[model samples]
Target chain A: MAASNIDPAIFEQLQAKIDEEGRIKDELKDIIQQLEKQGRVTQSILSRIHNTPTGQLGPAVFQPCERSILTQIHLVKVLSDIASKHPFYKWNNLWTREMQNLIFCLQLRHWLAHQELETIEQVGNELGVPINVKDRDIFHLTIEEYLLALTNTIDELTRLAPNAVTLGDFSRPLQISKFIKDIHAGFQLLNLKNDTLRRRSDGIKYAVKKVEDVVYDLSLRGLLPKQRSSDDTPAEAKGGAGAPASDMDSDVFLEG
Target chain B: MQMAGMKRSRDGPKPQGRADWDSPYIPMFENFRAELDEHHDRREKIIKASRDITASSKKIIFALQRVRNLGEKIPPPLIKSKEYSQHTSTIHERFVSVAPDLKGINAYRYQRQISPGIQEFMEAVLFRHYLETQSILSPSESAKLISENVLLTEDDYVLGLFDMTGELMRYAITQMATNGELPASRTGGRGNILTGLQDLRTKLEALDVSGSYGLSKNAEQKMSTTRTSVEKVENAVYSMTVRGKERPKGWNPGMDTSRPVGEVEG
Candidate 1:
């Protein structure tokens, strides 16, 4: 309104800011690639169990998993600084690819370490990044990015469902079903407007159905454990269970 | 949530040598790591290429600005010169070289990251073309030169055009301020930049951009920005004609036409 003036000082400040962002953005690319590498390494823990005897995975697998988790936590700290500082805005793209990659790492590690999905607030706390930093905090991943990562993790879990059955872990199918449903409910609570987010959120139902079908198939074959069916196991209860139940096969009733 | 059970397994005995669990996943892990490494390298190359495109495109915009003070008619030799072709071709070549990389990465996945460079390139090239030719560069025309056989989405084209309007507004204002008046139309009456701005506004306003998800809202916001830019140019032109009448002929508003003589010390 005031004669379209371009102040030289303000322009120089903007150039400096862009330069800083460029440096950080390049650094984030490297960090995201590392996070993905660590995620794949952590994922090997699940795959290793598939090749070995169901009850014989011993404590060795924990070594790599722990290393991967530690590296990811470090990366998430760096990612949080960038995300909370330079998040989506007028000059910048709001939803960042780097944040999505970081979210994937955070979710993958939590799922492997705790066997449970991590809530956004829980993740924020773990990374020392606060979600309630008012508007445009670039250091924190937005709820939408978290939901996208959750959808990707569900896809990863769906891939693992068959391996669980092969390992004679029928209870895992039920656990996955419950886990995915809880995540689906979390997504339903958010008011999504981005077309991609809406479409991906719609996909949660399919994942829920896929996991349910696995449970249904196991149940129809009478492979399910004789647990208290009248009472539903809360998701957090099973997720927090220490160690894979090596005696899970004993719980299954085999029919001749 | 058995805390004791968790602790026990976490601190369990280490496996001895020749443990076979790692064998099954070792190759798979190596393959995944290799793929990630390749992707990282490819992205770095793309970023470099996009930066090259931005720098060259800015030079092209600077070249276009060189013609502003010359006159309404851009020299025919300059329009067809090797220099112009080289700048435009550099963009085409850069994009073409990165076509495979962009395909593998999926452009939309990194759209927000790479979009500033792409949009800036668009603004520069499109502004240059508009200067040479009085018409706005259509999406297809821009795509042909810069998209490198890979079609840029309509949304990206529209977004690029949104910024181009700002460039046009600035060019018009600078021309009027430094040259004493806007460039005359072909019939030698109204300014050509004014007509170009009006035409661009009308064309952008008539489009049905509602079908694009997430873009419609952005389109509304950009429309307001484009409107403001147009008004600024119009205001500058208004002041030049109505307010500069009292000044002598050939008096540029921004330049020092009549410097005050310093007093000589005896």
Candidate 2:
């Protein structure tokens, strides 16, 4: 059947409602910008600590960055409240679609602050957001977005490997190599589609190779431990043994 | 691996489960996935409707073009014609059909997705209007003509006008090649496509539109293209008039004579 023209009053009302939605979207965008700015500052400050020696780095290195991340968390909480007032859950997956970068940065910071991945429940607990509330009623990062953020964090760690070797931190390279390899193994278990997650998972191998190269360079100069693992597999455990790169089980040291 | 769905009730009385705050069995948000599906469905409907509107609007432009040689009685502008009214009504009907689905979605948010169809429709409508009545359309009048609820923003309106100038350039060249009746200037001579184009340029230039957020640059680029189209029309008309004197008597410019019009000696 052919459609008819809408009633004038209903049309006007719809226009007004759409206008209100647009206004709210603009406000949300402004808040997102603030969150992004704070995230960048937190990243730069944390990067300073990543390069500095552990003993030389004072509490001051983490204090200001923690404050910045907390501010971002507060902004996210405020955005969550504002988003709940509208049907934002139905509105094009706005959390992941419009603010993927912002949320990824937040997750990266939260992961850096604590060595472990930041669980959704932990973030809600820290921010005083009710976890038991019905889904879609709360705005939290999805696991997929967290995994994407984890990929970015791994990329940052890979970049830090050469700096660690240059700064006479031989142990840091082994730690980073072991950490990233564990992440790569976890990614292998997942059946990711041909999207950001799969693309990022593909990048994990390059990070592993980069860290291995740093370790190899250090070991050539007689800087690496003779056998760091303390296992009977001396050939594979040594840093520059030139073991095959395609062994899938070689990096499966940490199981999620 | 546990990806929970997110959904919210749009309109209803508050559900009774709020009172049981300590109930160990909280229902999983199964309905949230339904909302995402609905959003996709709604977008599909609007896109289909916009396509229909674009097709019908093009037909209206063709119909308006049929009356190009009406010998001065073009029936009170083509927009007031039966063909124009019928086509515009259908466009409004399609727009109204999608109104319910787009309740909370700002039309501008999808402007990038949907504006091509709309701007093409605008080009057809504005071109017909300009052919019948030699005045350019204001943004407000365009908004009203489009529909009451749908806001044809100034940026889109100006962008549509930019395309309309291109169409007008083609129309002017065709009209001069066939009928040899030029677009009238204030001085009122036979060949005046240049005057009409100049008027349009002046009117568009007078608009205060520097702050239209990214649209300003597009409008500027299109404005230059519109000027080029106008120049093409002017050059075509200039050659036609200059070479017309060299043709023999009783020469119908519309006719496909044995020789090129420029080659025919007086």
Evaluated at residue B143, the lDDT of candidate 1 is: 70
Q: Which residue runs does candidate 1 get wrong by more than 4 Å?
A: A1-256, B1-24, B69-73, B76-86, B103-114, B189-191, B206-208, B249-266
> Model 2 misses residue B173 by how many Å?
1.6
lDDT of 1 by residue, A1-256 (tens): 2211112342233334445545655665666677667766766664574444333444545555667667777876765556544433321243355456556656755664555767667767766666523233245545556667778788777655666676655656666665665566555545454467778878877776676667656654555554444235433333322224332233232441
Tell me the tens digit of each residue's lDDT in model 2 across B142-177. 666665445465556667777887877766666665
The TM-score, computed over Cα atoms with residue i paired to residue i, of candidate 2 is 0.57
Tens digit per residue, CA lDDT, model 2, A72-123: 7788788777765754433325445424454445555554443335554565
What is the per-residue lDDT of model 1 for residues B12-116, given as tens digits with 9 covering 90 to 100?
111112332122223433443454446457667777877888777777776676675322456766667788768778877888887765552245434554565
Fnat, one value per model:
0.00, 0.00
Worst 10 residues of 1 chain B by lDDT: B8-17
What DockQ does each candidate score versus the true complex, computed on alpha carbons?
0.03, 0.04
lDDT of each: 0.58, 0.56
